[model samples]
Target: MKWLLQLVLTLSVTFCFTTAQNPEAAGRASSWIGGAEHEGALRALKWLEEAQDLGDGGGGWGSDAPRALLALQLSNCSWIPNAGMKAELAATKLELQIALLLWRHHEPPISPGRLAQYTLALGAMCKDPRDFHGHDLISLLLRHEPESDFEFAFVTLAVCNSGSHARKRHIRRLLDVTGDTDKHSADTLAMVVLALRCVAQEHRHRDLLRFVAPPALALAALQQADGSFGNLHTTALAMQALEGAGAIAWDRGAAMNLVLSSQAPDGSFGDTFTTTEVVLALQSRGLAQVSQCKCNKPRLPPSDTELGNFTFS
Candidate 1:
């Protein structure tokens, strides 16, 4: 069974490379975001700001500090008007501190997903992932053996973003997983696309480009008639993945339309999590943007304004 899967993937990759060589067959992918999409993203950003937890020692939205911080960084919320900019930067700093705290003291072993999230968040904040508060987040991520394709993808992104070389075996694992299943959810496939793209960005891994296209093509195939790969959340992530992978085979305009249409009057897609992702996708930002982020350190709030003994299990 394993051998058959490998053979199938080998042939599929070969075919993808062959197709990619044809200019007409591999038509340029359309841009996913436009002026209207940018407007919608701003609205979603407003909604995220409104939904943030501003209680004492609170600067994050929801339980996922790393994700929230990454989302805000990607949105470049600091560019908002004067007071709004200050508040956004403060919130971002607090969120960063919260994420660091969680990383330092989370008991019962942090999962690869959470660690990867932290690593990406740190990168987005322009912090050193290799020496974050005495923790080498990149080393920690590399030490884990991802148990699923999701973990593999997350780990790959984190490792690559931290200016660390992802293990060749990790790339092989991603390719194998992408070939092993057609039943992968849009979220999983999208993540795979981003991860593979990260690997392809390095000159050393240029040879791995052939393996990158199959998963992207598979993700493109999952697009629904309404331009979504699934719901609003999955659609948002899928858009990012396709764009990041440079696989413009999907319907960019329709996908953006669906995303914009799903917005509530409050300028949100639904919840905080969904809103964050939708904002990132609408802005055409992905995990890869973390490495490119040029951030200014926001002035820390008073010592009394700390996270207040918050603990992560």
Candidate 2:
């Protein structure tokens, strides 16, 4: 039976590799940060830089999560030596810093900024950032803007090492922030649950727990039996929520085991951006595990020219 289960997982992974379509930005970013080929990681970063929000210097408009995600990915690539890689990383860092500054100091309802975006992006850069930043970036995030699901969840992860007071403040702020927003689409709702669950785990809040229960249960009920989620990023975030909300007991060993067994051989994930986000989330959890999956596809040599070489920028 054990061998049979391994066979099934192997076959399922093989089929996914044979059929993957457009490279998912999230998955690729995760793999790169986890130490995949430098060129492949660069390509993913390039995609993210190109996709930046030109409208705002920070990267994009309201809650530009993708651009934020990509910038952080570029930041993680800082260890590389290639000129193109270095340049791209530098650009993303500046863009993300600018965005973070905007979120902290900019007016209006403090939407997720370069810092928040960079938070997840940075998660992709390496294992995690628990030891990376010194100043309370989460406090910076709260002071500047209204809390949302994304912000709450991110701040909780960011403040893992922070003292108790700040954790409560962030969690309270998250609950307060999402209470008023009308953005209850399935995805947004999932984001809200994600935030609440994480915060709740660190510092239990009855109100937040009450608020998150229905959605959290709904999301867990939605998980497929094969462990393949309906949506990749959503599933990943939902996992965070479940773990946070105490739905799944915080067993790092068990969780890591489940994740290892579920990962695709190509080092990518099961759903969209599967590779990128799975790595990011796992790293954020402080798992030092590296990806065992390798691409069977031919490796591309790094191009010496900049991305804009073919077209006028």
Per-residue C-alpha lDDT of model 2 across residues 193-297, encoded as one tens digit per residue:
665544444343334566676555555555565553345565555555565555542343443345556655444344324444554454433111111112121
> lDDT (0-100) at residue 193 of candidate 2?
69
Write down the lDDT that model 2 would get. 0.42
**10 residues in a row with least lDDT, candidate 1:** 22-31
RMSD of 2: 19.0
Query: Which pairs of residues clash in candidate 1, taking residues 3 or more apart in a chain or in different chains?
Result: none
The segments of candidate 1 whose C-alpha lies over 4 angstroms from its true place after superposition are: 1-32, 53-60, 77-106, 295-313
RMSD of each: 18.0, 19.0
Please give the CA lDDT of all the candidate structures: 0.66, 0.42
